[model samples]
Target: MSSYLLPAIAGLLTGAGLIVAIGPQNVFVLRQGVARRHTGAIVAVCAISDVVLIVAGVAGLGAIVAAHPQVITVAKLLGGLYVLVLGLLAAKRCLRSNEAIAANAEEAESAGRWVAVGTALALTWLNPHVYLDTVLTMGAIANGHGNGKWAFAIGACVASILWFTALGGGARRLSHLFASPRAWKILDAVVAVIMIGMAVALFASI
Candidate 1:
């Protein structure tokens, strides 16, 4: 038990560090959080996805994935295309930025829940960077712990849950600041840039 302590702490810190960075998923979560739209569902999706990925990585799927170069090539191509499309959509939203402010509960409820769910799934599963971080890098680190790998995975899973919960739930506090359409436009523009940049980077690496 004592031996697992260090690995658990290491996994927690590593998971937090990797996830806290600004990315398309985080941006989407932040936007949903500020809008108070399906924030709980989004957070659950992200946390569950991370848990599944982390489990796969720890269970040795990482090594198998790494062995298949073609799989990664395909993932890169698809992921890049998906991200590019999302970036374009975000840019378009910036152009028509009337509804950028926070939505009332009724408005948020009326919005298509399926749309949000689909977008969340795409932003998560279509990002090759997620595979690289959670599978390859985190897998390598977990395997380094030998028998303690499961402990590490648990810590990492916890980290994901905690981070997404805080990010999605705490964003409402800043709702006043993003109340303006202009602020939302600017935010979308930045998200567009980041998503496009990530897409470009993905293609370049392939």
Candidate 2:
């Protein structure tokens, strides 16, 4: 019991360190959370995706991925293009007034569940950083524990669940502040900049 406990705790801390950063996935989750649209599904997709990646990493797929640079190169190019489009869309939204933004929200709500889930999946799976962090880095660390690696994996999964739950669920508290059109515009503008910057970084890497 103590064996599992120690490794699990180590995994929890290590996973938190990898995930709690400001990335494209975190940005999308926060936006959906504030809009209160398909927040649950978005959170679920992100967390579950992490679990799958982490498990794969622990299973030694990370080593295979590390050996294959072309896979990551493909993901980087595709993900960069996708994120660039999202950034441009957000920049367009930033130009709209309060009423238009509100109407857009309403329209989004009607069709956003699946859309949000799709975005969540793309942002999670397409981003090469996720592979580097969760799969390559965490997987290598977990293997060091040998017999306790599964316990470590469980702990890392738990960290992902908790982080996404808190991020998506707790963002509602800021919804009141986002009620103003100007606020929405500002938020969108920031999102655009971040997304674009991330896209640029990904392209530059390749």
Candidate 3:
């Protein structure tokens, strides 16, 4: 039990560190939270996605990834381009004068539920960083725990669940702060910076 405890704690901390980074998936979740639109569904999707990835990582996908370097290269090229596009769109949103958080469910409902779900899936699955972090990095780390790898995976999975829940649920309370269009613009600007920075970093690493 003591052996498992340390790895579990390590997994939790490592998972939190990776997921806490501002990325496309997180920005989308924040937007949904602010809009108060299908927040639960989005949160669940993100958390579940992480869990699946993390489990795969722990199950030895990391070894396969390490053996084939070209996989990372291809993922980097495609993911970086995708992130770059998202950053540009975010920048455009910031420039628009009408950038405002929805104040009610009706306004938020303008976007179809399926659209939101599809976007969330794309943001989660399309990013190369997700593969790097979960399947490779986390997988390697979990395997380092030897017999306790499953325990570590559980800790990491729990972290993903908690973080998404907090991020999506907590944003609702801050809706009042984003009531102004200027606030939304500022948020978009910040998101644009994060996304573009990530894109550049992703490409640079390759």
Best by TM-score, which number?
A: 2
- Which 10 successive residues of model 1 have the least lDDT summed? 97-106
Report, for every candidate in turn, its global Cα lDDT versus the true structure. 0.86, 0.92, 0.87
Candidate 2 local accuracy as lDDT?
0.92
Per-prediction TM-score to the true structure, in the order listed: 0.91, 0.96, 0.90
Per-residue lDDT, model 1, residue 187, is 78
Candidate 3 per-residue lDDT, tens place, 1-206, comes to 89999889989999999999978899989988987888999999999999999999999888888899888888888778888888898798788755244343346568788888888888888788888898899999999899999989999999999999999999988888986778878987988998898889989999
After the best TM-score superposition of candidate 1, give how far the Cα of residue 131 lies from its true spot, in angstroms: 1.4
| Every candidate's CA RMSD | 2.4, 1.1, 2.4
Off by over 4 Å in 1: 97-109
The C-alpha stretches of model 2 lying farther than 4 A from their native spots are none
Which digits, one per residue and each the tens of the lDDT, describe model 1 over residues 3-90? 9988899889989988899888998899888878888999999999999999999999889889986777888898889889989987
Q: Which candidate, 1 or 2, would have the higher TM-score against the true structure? A: 2
When 1 and 2 are scored with lDDT, the better candidate is 2
Ranking by TM-score: 2, 1, 3
- Evaluate candidate 1 by giving its C-alpha RMSD to the native, one decimal: 2.4
Residue range 91-187, candidate 2, lDDT tens digits: 9999997888877776876875787889989999999998899999999999999899999999999999999999999986778888878988998
Instruction: Count backbone overlaps in model 2.
Output: 0
